[model samples]
Target: MSTADSLAKVIATLDWDGDLGPASLAVDEAEQLRSRLGDGATRWVAGAVEQSLTALHGQIHDSLAPWPIIRTFTRHVLTATLLRLADQDRLPVDTGAIDRDLAEDIVARGIPLSDITQALRSMQREWLSLLIDAALGVRPDGIGVVPALATSVTGTMDAWIGAATDAIVEERRRVYLAEQVRIRSAIELLVTAEPVDVEAVTQLLRIPLIGWHLSCAIGVPPGGTVERRVLDGLVHLFARVVGSERMLRYETSAGTVHLWVTTDRPARTPRVEDLRVPAPLLVGIGEPHPGPDGFRRTFLEASDALRLAGSLGDNGGVSYGDAALAIVLSRDEERARWFVEHELRDLATDSPEMADLRNTLRTFFDTRMRIAPAAERLFLHRNTLINRLDRIQAVLGHGVAERPAETQAALVLAELFTRRPEDPSTGRHEFGA
Candidate 1:
């Protein structure tokens, strides 16, 4: 055969479906050479590639680091290249479908595009080495065959790389654009509080419309910028924990993330501790409710809880519904402050002596003013407890025995407002020692 026809024969072999191993074609000289020499070479090369996958996995360590996928890609590409050489006829090696799928997967995994490029290049090198080995082992006299084989391998790989690179880049771009649209639409639909197409919001955000939903308000301390990578990691982790993609998130300009997570069963709502949120960032979870209106309500409650946590010097998560009374009272800061200051008067100031006195008063009321029980609870002698109560009466200019209910209510207010030290300007920020 002419060199052109020989190359054509090699390429056409790829399109041939019948087995061409030596056992299947011993009688025919041409079939025997192509089988033992061509298909056999490809099989030997594929085995070598399979053995090298573990080492390759170590080199390309990332989200797309599964060895089986790498192994398959390697075997498929090498087999196609070798078959082309055996038939010597042009056969299309269309790996675009697989490339597009891999690209989409890589993008979803948040892996860098460079990793894909590096992985493909690594495959080329490994395949080339095996092809050389196969050539030496099967066709010792065919030095001319080696060059033709090498040319075919390189050409096929380059085509695969170019097509895959384009597909990966385009897929990554599309994913990012879609995320932006979803976030923008979610933010608008939530903030406006107008009745929107719930189905549209659900489809856009990929979250459920009718189910138990808990909103979480996540934010860093003032003056801190939200790290996108950290936030993305948090979102991904949260979704994984819930075992669902039915979650929506929107990040505010002030470095706060408003998130909604839904589950069909109310009992399955994720708890604050389960989230394992890290510092300088606080998370506030809302009560779980059903449907779109529930989502909105829970979001508002979560926002309130976030503010309440900040106010209480709580640098962690707070459940809004659990602390409803305090949260409601905290809304009127001036009134709450005034109520605490006027009601407690000189008794609520920050000092060890005052704290002791306040504790004694609290203990006395908790025991229903029973002197012995109050003293026992304080781990004090009755006379000592009486002396503390006397001190409290002296500070207030009235005895606890006079209108105890009013005093108890006043003490409750004091506990809420003055439990932590007030910063004078920023209200409570630090706890009194």
Candidate 2:
């Protein structure tokens, strides 16, 4: 650590001109590498990494591959900053903290050395592949380039930079793909994965085990890549279980997919509510799971969306996440009361006939406002309706006279009673509707 050596290191760092060559050695290596390596791609991965920085604000990266690299780097740097703040119990970066000196601070402080280092090592290969696949955008799964269908700037995804540790993106891809397949296959089998089907999944998808009754889930892209295969394969099985109902599968982790399933028939998407969930994870297909907000979407929403699509038969897709609170946890007596009280405001109360009406209302709303020849087709009397009405109004109070409020209140209750809280693992009993 001589002063001249330190000065040389500083100058060399400043130059970023060449590796192993003296600070003065200027090589056309970058351009040559770009020409030699990019396959006519716009940017070279090596140059991208060499020049990458973790800024306080957002970056100015190109729209493809290396974007993940920049994003991952940016996130880790930001994370390191936050962690530092957390350690010192002070807020270092915030809306105003993009102080421009954070980089120097990180370099000086060696922030999050172990974490950033490990993440970078792990993410290396993915970053390199990103140079190729970001532009490809999942279309590669379909034979040749497939003519790069009118791609749009839908959103961005990032892989934490692993190149910093001298690892490449390819290696990380192996790790990322293996983990992703494991999760996807697990969820696939957990819900509908059969024992016989397990072997094929293991061989094809490389997932190892299929546990029973676990509320596991996996990230799914909106359309392309693996999502199509996963959802399309499940369609037939879903069709058997609930004819004419919609199905949906949201990645619930990424911003890339706002996957939506729509149709003109019956459907069901389990509204997200706090419930026991398997270990939550994030992957590259979409966005990083923003935690519970990310995991909030349940297989139920995807199911409902698919069912609806089948009904009207209009094809649809699954979607994304910015984090969502699962409403299932709120389906308790308080929330049920709160929903009615808020929506109905004046329509929440208890009366016997109202109790019966409540039952009918729950059925009607849960059935999506269709209580017609079905209810009457069972053969009821006009007085039956009249009595139900009287009790409903009696319990709901003066606001029940207000058609809008009354309708909304009844709807919330109906939906409330329909939460799927039947996790045998938690010993919570099923709600017998």
Candidate with top TM-score is 1
**Which residue runs of candidate 2 sit more than 4 Å off their true CA positions?**
1-336, 341-355, 361-378, 399-406, 418-433
What TM-score fits each model?
Answer: 0.53, 0.25
Least lDDT summed over 10 consecutive residues: which range in candidate 1?
A: 424-433
* Model 2 error, position 33 (Å): 36
In model 1, state the lDDT of residue 304: 74
lDDT of 1: 0.64
Taken over the whole model, the C-alpha lDDT of each candidate is 0.64, 0.33
Question: 19-108, model 2: which lDDT tens digit per residue?
Answer: 321121113433332232232211223333433332211232323323333443443332332122112212222323222233333334
lDDT (10s digit) by residue, model 1, range 151-231: 777888777666666777788788888889766766566645767787777776677777878777887655556667876
